[model samples]
Target: MFGDMMGMMSKLKEAQAKVEETKKRLDTVLVDEKSSDDLLKITLTANRTIKSIDIDDELLQDKEQLEDYLILTLNKALEKATNINEAELAAAAKDGMPNIPGMNF
Candidate 1:
């Protein structure tokens, strides 16, 4: 039983390492989202770090409209990044997890 526990601990450690690595890798994975009218564009990493925001000249003419567009586009981009980050991290963790008795993942 102790041996099994030790092995399980090792597997957990490895899984944690893999998760960290995946997070680092996700920093390079970019997600792009734009407004419906293409007046605003957002680029972010899978880690949910904003890389850039592109706004059209027309958007600059209307402050309120620009704010609304930025909000919508940034929300969409963040959602996409969150999905990607979750999926990749889950995959990394699941792949490294050790199979133990009576524990259903």
Candidate 2:
């Protein structure tokens, strides 16, 4: 019984290490997205934190157009970031799963 407990603890430690490594990798992931017309662009981290935004000078003259472009571009960037995050998490979980025959994570 004690040996089984020790093996479980070892697996837990490995999973924790993999999670930390994945978090570090996520911090370095950058995603850039642009609007359909290429009038607006945004950059964000996999953690969904915006790094920068760019807008075309022509759009500055129209507040409504600029707002619309910003919203659309930002949403695209955020969605990409969210997808990346989800994929990374799933990969980490798969890597951390205990090795057992006839079992799936």
Candidate 3:
């Protein structure tokens, strides 16, 4: 029983380490997304933090249009970041545990 507990503790430690590593990598993962009209662009990290945004000069003249495009672009960037985050987490979980039957991770 002690051996089993030790093994479980070791796996937990390894999982924690992998989670930390994933967070570090997420900080460096930048995802860029653009509006359909190509008038707006946004860059965000996999952790869903906005980094930068670019808007066409013409759009600056129309506040409503600019706001709409900005919203669209931001949503796309955030969604992409979410997908990347999920993938990274899955990879980290896999790295932490090689094969455990019936276990999703």
Error of 3 at 25 (Å): 0.7
What C-alpha lDDT do the candidate models reach, one value each? Answer: 0.95, 0.86, 0.87
lDDT score, candidate 3 = 0.87
Q: What's model 3's TM-score?
A: 0.88
Best by lDDT: 1
lDDT of 1 by residue, 1-105 (tens): 999999999999999999999999999999999999998999999999999999999999999999999989999999999999999999999988999889887
User: Which run of 10 residues does model 3 get worst, by summed lDDT?
Assistant: 96-105
The alpha-carbon lDDT assigned to residue 69 of candidate 3 equals 90
> TM-scores across all candidates?
0.96, 0.87, 0.88
Residue 46 of model 1 has an lDDT of: 98
Steric clash pairs (candidate 1): none
Segments in model 1 whose C-alpha atoms lie over 4 Å from true places? none
True-vs-predicted CA distance for residue 28, candidate 3, Å: 0.6
